[model samples]
Target: MNTDPRPSEHASPCDAAADWFVRLHSGTVSKADLRLFEQWRQADPEHDRQYRNVCRISGAAQHLSAQALRAILKQDAHPATPQQHRRLSRRAFGLGLVGACSSVLVMGVLHRQGLFDEPLETYHLQTRRGEHQELALPDGSILRANTDTLAIARLYEGRRTVELRRGEVFFSVARSTRSPFIIDAGSTEITVTGTRFNVSRTDSAVQVAVESGSVEVSGGRWWNRRTRRLAAGQAVTAYHDAAPEGIRTVDVTNIAAWQRGDIIFDDTPLALALEELNRYLPHPVHLDDTALRSHRISGIVRSGKPEAMLEMLPDFAPVSVHRQADGQIRILPR
Candidate 1:
């Protein structure tokens, strides 16, 4: 017998519930199967929760308009149901219906729209890995998509909405009282009233740097912690598992210069600055010297040249930057 406290067989029901949900979302299940699924869902609380997760993901897919869906599908070949609906092949379709229906594209859609209901029209723009793009929104706001960023946005009725699920983005708002905009980045909520700023959220924390105007940041509390508001020329960072910390006044112009193809750092630790600089290069930059990790860097780096960044690092620290044949950058102590 297994000694672990967790019920080993508990996951099977959840997995099965997820499968039933995908079929329901794809509109493939017959009426009889739908009744059977409802029976299964009502049987247990875990089944209901698992089914909701699947629906939330699937609902996001349905929110994408016909034009956008076709465009996205065109970029990649999606498995479509045949007109006659033959039996699934036993070889390639090894996971059966689960793998085929629970695709990233469909799940991503659900994740975006399932946050709220009532069909709030929002405008959105995004870019792929190794790519950066900019666009002007319907509300006259300007959006800059950092590499590997995806955004969903809309300005409808009386509210403006923008959702950034990953990567970094800079927003320059046009200012509208009738529709105060809100941005959902991970667990942080940024409310804007005609301001310019940049927000970056990673797996660990969320960083908000203000260029112009003030913004409200809420819900980064840890136990009895308090929320912080960031003003122009200020930056604040909030991380998971810890209370939000660090409120500093910095030059807004230098911080915002990355939008103009310049990377600037001011007494920033090499380890932290390396994380920001690596975003601009095709190949990732890594530090090999443990001793050089804590060195502080303050300078301007041109965005396009990885080799130039490597060369400039030798001036501030006792380290040499080397480029491997495979294109990854490695930093070594000199």
Candidate 2:
């Protein structure tokens, strides 16, 4: 949560919920524990959603064989904390309780981060600045690449992997019992079974948001990595070589609204807003007064009409926007 990448720092409400879920169902429940769990659930509305997701996935995986579960623990390559290590051993080996789960709880049916044994065919998906494209993969998944994005897709018999080279991608993945969809974004790895999510990669960071279903965001040191499960309407951001920050609540409907040709900002900083607008603008936008960077901006601009973002600048912030003869836009304090 503080960008430390340590499990202790980055564990989200979802992570805590998973631990509580396992403790309660492990035949080791106590009255005090239940009371504390209830307090946690009530403290934040997101906790309930996170806990329900864990239960639903665990219920679906109740029929998996013990051997299948073992394979998951071994191949996951995630370094669990001492406490989590114990829980994972009990969950994977005991098979009575599964902790920190997604839909791919069955190891025989799961592939960690799309690492496959079969020879795979590869292809690329990309979009130039201001361009948007939607593609349907052979595996029945629909992928949308936003402006200035590059993603590589590799298809094998049972699993699929996509590396986000740059920019943003929104996925509507098809469900598979024996196959999982994986996305490698810089230093982070995301695993999914069936879900809709948006991943945006920038020069310095990657952000993941779930619109429906859920995703596991994994990163941090290889010897001590951390993973957080984000349910629908939740989002996480991480810098390169770091674990994801604390998960944040979001409006899932606005996740990747650019796919609909709309760019929505909710009280964003002026400098940051202009940075995003530059992605679609033919000419870069610059702020003349550094002090103006603190100004807040909130509005909707049509992606197809990038210039309109500049037009609306004056209506919100205490700044004036002007277009140069060369087409570049500059903002100055009023």
Candidate 3:
């Protein structure tokens, strides 16, 4: 007596098996129901094959939690009853189906890259949700990349240069007055010899915070270039598509605390705080409303406290924080 289930020649068992596949794995099916399902599947070899194929489809998507699956289902706008929902669950959990969906997302991104070309060896450096990193360069320089920070190093000629694509970094220069270090943040170019300073590239402007030593920041129209000398404790901002703003003095240690795996928000905006917090951990943190994000917040957040950081946020702002299964934090207006 072969226990292998074959598909029914009289009726289509594939669809039914698919529904069962999801229900069986959902931890709700009773032992009696499971026995019945097994009996039905083992009735024929075709039934067995059909059920296995259906299960295969949903197995690939196991990384998606039940909540995410339900969200996707809800988006379909199908008025599905609880029983019908169970029927569709198998397709939702199948690995092959989920992988196929991911492929579509990747294809969309790649298509946007170019019509017939793709980038070669894309480099990315990002801080985790609640983590920060102090990257030491080969040239003996140090980069204190803040939370949710990313910098791409591009080598050219005798000079070492880095492009601050997003977030902030404190560069500690080593003595090698010969090879000058340059950092490009948006329209601004920060040139340094043997100095230490912080550089942040936000959507609004590019900021330079100098610590030890000095640096020359230059930016403006392609033809007209303006430069400013920033001394220790001095900071400057260069606006987008505009000239360099005047420089001012600030606490060097407070601005460079990310290097020590800490974020000090001195009445800073909530949105900015979340952006800084996203650097260290492997999770994402999102800010919802501009008004709520603009609220002032002051606190000292240590590393590896993503939950604690989020819990403290409500005290400063009228917002709600939710944890996603993929380790992402969602902030919404209360």
Candidate 4:
């Protein structure tokens, strides 16, 4: 009986697989190189398995933002000795580049060697309930996050993209001819060169109100994309799984009053007003009666101090506020 090991079970193919994986992502692989890679991959079963393992390991790391990868690499800045480099390389192949330490070292070395192109920096910003935050972006743009807002900004070399994960944000974009400021709010995407606008994203809808300059709003699915351009004082709403609403004129000053600790409602429904107010209070305000939802409210409500607003609500409408045992405030008909 022959006691020889099969070629597919050998370790040499795994080593070659790792080298090919690095070369493929170097951004300079030619068509002939890819063809040769395919031949090599199909030559041995072990080669394909190793390639798939490398892919699975790198998939999760790809989701990591460029900033996070850089932060990980910054933790170890000293040049690795020849022995350490070889050890790390061996560990990278053995671990399939899945471990955090091995992944960081491999990515860092690949980046320095121009084998991997770095992606854009991604930043996550959020504000708690009843809180507000202001940020100055690297591109000189200003962002004012409202209460309970969650946003992610990805600043690439050619474009600046901000995704409004939840709630509302007011953006004062700086002028940049080379890079456009884009915001992805749920289903809608608002793009502008340099404009001031407010993007509010709810559970089922997104609203974009342009305060100054112009913006292009695009929504709907990938196949049937809908787009509309809005100028100053114009607002647009896009419902989830629905078409974009017609642009309407709005009072920019009243819409943006929340930035100054005030919530202005001009013939707005009571339910909508309550929803906006609840964003700024620890305890949410709920309307007990369905009919009370249609009550039109037109006034300036103070933020952070919900007691005054609750007190004045009874005067404006025939509704009473009840403080529940659970610290929630319910509005019902008197």
Q: What is the C-alpha lDDT of each candidate?
A: 0.65, 0.72, 0.64, 0.72
Give me the displacement of residue 243 in model 3, in angstroms: 5.0
Rank list by TM-score: 4, 1, 2, 3
Rank the models by lDDT, top first. Answer: 4, 2, 1, 3
Predicted candidate 4 versus true structure: per-residue lDDT over 29-66, tens digit per residue: 46777888888889879778877766654543323334
Point out where model 1 deviates above 4 Å: 1-114, 128-132, 146-148, 155-158, 201-205, 219-226, 240-242, 288-294, 332-334
Tens-place lDDT digits, model 2, residues 1-334: 1221111334576676655554454333457767877887787788788787567545323223334443443353453345544444455545444443432232224333222234477878989997888878887999999998899988877777788988889999999868878888867889899999999886657789999999998865432346889999998877677888888898988998988889887766677677778878889988879898768888898988978878877887898888789988888888
Candidate 3 C-alpha error for residue 28, in Å? 74
Report the lDDT tens digits of candidate 3 across residue range 132-206.
Answer: 677676667777776667898644444566778888877888866766777877667888888988888766567
Question: Which of the two candidates, 3 or 4, achieves a greater TM-score against the reference?
Answer: 4
Question: Which one is best on TM-score?
Answer: 4
- Give model 2's TM-score versus the native structure: 0.58
* lDDT of candidate 3 at residue 7, scale 0 to 100: 23
Candidate 3 RMSD to the correct structure = 19.8
- As for candidate 1, its clashing pairs are 57-110, 60-109, 60-110, 122-153, 122-154, 123-153, 123-154, 124-153
